[model samples]
Target: MNTFLNTLNSNNMQTKKPFKNLKIFASGFLMLTGLVATAQQTTGDVVKKADVDPGTTITDGAVRVIDNKGTIKYLQTQNGITMLSNTTANVTTTTWQLGGVLTDSTFIDIDGKLFGLNGLELIDAATESASTDATTESDAGTGTGYTILVRDEATGATKKLLATELIQSGQEAFTATLAQTTFALTGAPVLPSFSQVWVYRNGAKLIANVDYTVAASTVTLVENDYAVYAGDIVEIQYVK
Candidate 1:
């Protein structure tokens, strides 16, 4: 490559016209292009995926190799250290944790009037404790060791959504166990407005002021006439 450039410079020095044969210039240019391609191949960075130590460093310009553990990983940096790792990894994860879709479920733009529900669909939960179905919902927010976090745009603070949040979607009933006062609502934090709530006793609807107070995940009866006795049936109705 240097010899080719020197030949061009020598030809330029010899002639006031700065003349060089077209064949020689073309040959020299092609040689230079080949040299450049070789240099690029030798010096360029490469990425490889294989297992490595925890604190391994990947150079900025090199091919960033990931420690492949039979799973795909995204390149990330932490405390100015570069690594290939998972972005969505949790310290501990549950089977029923909420997340974005992995593979897309079929989305037909069927409006609210299809089967039965206007817009909301009924998710079937398993009645048994061990079965994890669509309806095996956990209401214990505080005890579940997981929290739903929401960020405040105005204050720029992240906080946990209250545990045991229940929103009644439709009419439902539950038989209160013997001596149970505060019935853990099937859905919870209580409905916003009192006008939407209706609590019923055996066959008669209980009075609002004198009967029961609906709070988050609980329906507390007044314990007088409205008090829930042993094996008393309670019915609740509310909008979604």
Candidate 2:
């Protein structure tokens, strides 16, 4: 009976030992958790909070932000920062300003029109032709109230004309026949204004209304000392 009691006590002691080890393991786990929480709190205190102004100069790759009435505005870069939204920042003499010169690659889009540096036309040929067709319906004669945009060849200046003041028929050149008195224009262009013809006899420009008279499609030379003989070269240029 004594041996049985001793064995039963030894079994009970072994069970109690396992319970003590479980308590020690739980205490060690709690200590490890406390250390991690303390480390996280220390890290939070060391981290810097974003402020309104952090000085003007900043290193590259460092992010800077500003809070305006609970709205955040981020500005960070070595050069310029592209704003995705509309900016109300004013250009100041002491602050950032636009460059004086624009390169050829720079372009600006206003409404649906695309313009390049120094008022250059940046549209393709097809788009420009379509726009011109829509504006001027194949004809730009006088009294049509349509304006023609003309550019100065020498000065590079552009101007608009209400009437067809600059429209001119292309130069037409041909050899005169035997005793050719009347010459007909092959293009059959209409002349809105009279006395605007420029006739050239043998490559020399002649005075209008003095050398020849243009009536409708015919150009008849005045019965003067100079007459157009056979094989004589005749050139005519006039505003339609």
Candidate 3:
């Protein structure tokens, strides 16, 4: 009976030892689980105005990602969230005054000036500056009495004068002296060269190098056409 009693007690002790060890292991597992929960941080249903501290940080090359199910909602590297649908609205403090696609008809507003896709200003206003005095081609006119814009080579400003005020079709009329052969072309734009000089005698066009020859700014008629009377009309046509 004593020996049987000792064996029974020994078995009980062995069984209890395993239970104690299991209890210690369960306690250690529970403590480790609590530590793991503490290490993870979560943003609950409430909106946070101030910055919330995450208990643990990610290592190098690892970034925190916000996702719904498997789809990514936001990435840490990008400026804004990855939009999944149009139903959600994201508000940010960032803003810009100028932005538009080149293919779109909308203009990009820079300050108050709006520019088109071609980089042309859409706004119409007065002159860019008082000194500019610029005029578009629309401001020009043709025919008699109409004024045309001309740039003054001296001052480099655009000025306007009647079309009639310009040289008459590049033609200058002169009264020839009695039997004058050599005539000085003082009104010619520059010294006339060779065939560029076209001479007319009394409404008749004279052949160049046949009836007359030009040298420097002077035109000398051939001996046959040299009989220019005092009252004869001589006309010189040239290109400027």
Candidate 4:
């Protein structure tokens, strides 16, 4: 009876040890689960509070800010909104204007690149000043009238004219003597006066009773004005 009691006691003790170990393992697992849940809750709260709205304006006078780091920004105007900067700016009804004249500087347009006007006189890169005045002469002279010479810088070609006035009264015979130039006549077919001579290249109307002759590469236009007042257009044009 004593031996049997002792063995029973030993088995009970072994069983109690396994139950204690199981209790300890269960407590540790609960603690680890609680810690993980707390960390997840804190992370969720941080994410909710860190969210922000995007910016709207990019450039206003001096300030330069973008809406998003990777997304494209836009510019808003009275006409419409546009995507600007590295992207395209699609505007509506509004055109950009350069308030001041740009001198001695180049500018870029929608076409990529272009030249600007410079110097005392506005001269474009494509076209230049045709002639420069040397000296003013009297309207009356032995050679019909005053002479105005136009020189082309590119080709070194010169055009000369005997500037005579247009008279409305009695028949006035006006003549234009060109140096090494011939003009093709069309329209009303009238001769050109001094002031009207420039109108030739200006693309104006030609009057009547106009006679032209080309000799030794020189051209002369004779006009007999029976009627017609000053400022009446009588022009002609020449090539080469």
Candidate 5:
């Protein structure tokens, strides 16, 4: 009987009322842990403001260049450059404006790449080809006044593209002057490269260099060759 009474007492002790505060204590501990986690930097931390001023930075292998007004930027490996590029919204050609001129190496670096201006030659010719339609490659369209520009090496004059294949050799003419053998040419033409000189005297064709020698449009008769006298009809034609 004493053993039974002892077992019953042990059972009552084991079944004693559970404390309500324990669950609350555990709940408060989880809440406190959450608050602590919010208070401290755990992971993926981000700073709202930085201590340095950052300019412009592009990512390189490890680090790149950057600068800012507030602080000196990190990684000043090379200088930064700003180039402006402008174009029509849907145009294929883009024009780039550099802040300043670049060196030859710089030009080569930008122009000689695989996808750079490889096929295009120097812009020595400005007028469009005859085979090409007038509407093509035109800023305004049509050929009323379109002229290609080519620098005349011999004459040192800039020639306008006349047609699909020809140019206006600065049209030069000299009227006859009686007793005068010399004539002056305008400076704009630069008068050096003429393939042929036709001299028409008294409505008749005169021989070249034989009758007169011409150098840069300074016409002078052959020595003692005053065949071209005063009031003679003379027409000088220069063809290049």
Candidate 6:
């Protein structure tokens, strides 16, 4: 009976010893796993907060950003910063002033041909005059009206009439007489007191009856006819 009791106690001791060893091994493994988890967390935090070193070389496709004042700068290279592609930046204010009229000397460098208001019309510089007649029982009289000539400033160039010349009697004004078309001024034997006749080309009125006369195909006017005359002033404008 005593031998059996000693054998049973030894068996109990062996079982208890293995159980203690298993508990200690389990505790050690748990501590090792916890230490590995803590190390990973510390490394991640350091990486997140650390600045990129200047000596570090980044390959293509790597991206980094910098905050400068209110602008966000993108790192294009190790030492260079640039605005990001397709990003809009703020601009400053600007002012503008009105410029005066352009002159002929202004340089125009546009493609194709250039034209201006003067290019549309031909101008003449010759002066011309026409006659007006009024006849009464006691008086058979003729008065004259003059025209100022404006010609193309360019040499050998001809100008076309901008507007036709007309005759006015009382409240009636004659229709425009076109160039190369003949029309006669036929009226009562008596001429109206305010028989104001005039001519125009391009909105400019010609000088009254003192300077112009019509020949077969051309109109001629002398410079002296521009002087104001004692008789009536008539306006005649012509262009060819």
> Against the true structure, what is every candidate's RMSD?
19.7, 26.2, 27.0, 31.0, 25.2, 35.7
CA shift of 66, model 4, Å: 4.3
Candidate 3 deviant stretches above 4 angstroms = 1-169
lDDT order of candidates, top first: 2, 3, 1, 5, 4, 6
Cα lDDT tens digits for candidate 2, 67-171: 324343332221222112112331110122232222122222244767445865464554333222224324444232335567667754555654434555656
Question: Candidates' TM-scores?
Answer: 0.29, 0.34, 0.31, 0.15, 0.33, 0.14
Which order, best to worst by TM-score? 2, 5, 3, 1, 4, 6
What are the Cα lDDT values of the candidates? Answer: 0.45, 0.49, 0.48, 0.33, 0.42, 0.32
Q: What global local distance difference test value does model 2 have?
A: 0.49
| lDDT for 117 (candidate 5) | 41
Q: Evaluated with TM-score, which candidate comes out highest?
A: 2
Cα miss at 67, model 2 (Å)?
38
1-240: candidate 6 lDDT, tens digit per residue: 233225336556564553464356445544533422422323332222222222232222222332223343222211111112211221111111123232212222234757344554333335533423322222223333322234456643333331233433322223333332222233432332212333433344555444444443223334453333233233342222
For candidate 3, report its TM-score.
Answer: 0.31
Backbone collision tally, model 4? 3
Error of 3 at 45 (Å): 56
**Candidate 2 residue-pair clash tally:** 0
Q: Candidate 3's residue-wise lDDT over 1-240, tens digit each? A: 233224336556564553464456445545533433422233565222222112222211112222224342221111111112112222111111122222212211245666335765543235321212323433323222334568678855556754444543366778888988887767544544656778899989888888888776677888673578897888887753
Model 1, CA-based lDDT: 0.45
